[model samples]
Target: MQAECPRQPPFNCSCTLDNVVWDTSRLYLIPIITVDCSGLGLTELPGVLPSNTTSLLVKENQISDLRPLVNNEHYRHVADIFLDDNLVESVAVLEGSPWLFNFRVFSLRGNRLSQLPTYALDNALERNRHVVDIFLGNNPWQCDCLFTPSFQVNTEEG
Candidate 1:
């Protein structure tokens, strides 16, 4: 017999964790699964995620490190990720991960990121510049010599 995915009717939560109900109805369509667990006060990413998750919305939480998400085979299909209003200090989680390849929209607004590794953004740009939309605002950005070249180029281009 095939294992059945349990359904909770009262709250309409498809997946329950730590008494927090995850509304799985936000899933737009088959190829575009959107799991929105926003404003749940979550400290970390959920261990068991839907294997077909394409857009993950986990904003307004206390998630600090994203390293745990790197090895999760379930996250391989993620394209759009919204991690705003969290405690993310660094994106070392995506430093060398293959997820950077298909990563389309990454919004880190209102986080603790100081600087992003240009190589990672460069890789995403190399893949598809027009499809990538990275939002990095409302953080204490470090504008040092490391940013001189790119800053000058972008300033000139702008």
Candidate 2:
């Protein structure tokens, strides 16, 4: 079935779904458009995201898994994502997702994550070494040899 575009401003730069807005202003020569759906108390990832979305902000929700991103085409253009303060425990959903290679930032500062898939982390870090900024602090992280070796730590805080 064909997906319908959500209601948004006539600027053709945003799509709204169930009170969630997917910003696409970057396509109109405006400031970088970032889809901000934070603090919505949502339990599942939204079904649709515009392919033009550059930054996705879905923090402070109840989302547990990220597999839905792989099921849609919108994930390809995403450069950054903010999923902090959620219920995410496993990111194995993103194992073979090509989007990891081009990500500029991925924040999961406050979640339920205790472990990450090693091979996925290694592949993402190696391919996008100088560009990706991954944040995984304040979670129930199991500090072990397997987890420690793949990721780099930032000593300073923002």
Q: Which is the leading candidate under TM-score?
A: 1
lDDT of 2 at 128: 74
Instruction: List all candidate RMSDs to the true structure.
Output: 7.9, 7.2
Quantify all predictions' global Cα lDDT against the true fold: 0.66, 0.69
Backbone clash count for every predicted candidate, in the order shown: 0, 0
Candidate 1's residue-wise lDDT over 9-36, tens digit each?
2212133222223457984434335666
lDDT measured at residue 139 in model 1 versus the true structure, 0 to 100: 68
Best by lDDT: 2
- Residue-level lDDT of model 2, residues 1-119, one tens digit each, is 01333223321223333233435764343234466667777776665665456777878888887876666676677678889999999898887777777778889989999988878
Model 2: how far is 136 from its true place, Å?
0.4
Stretches of candidate 1 exceeding 4 Å from the true structure: 1-31, 128-130, 151-158
Off by over 4 Å in 2: 1-32, 149-158
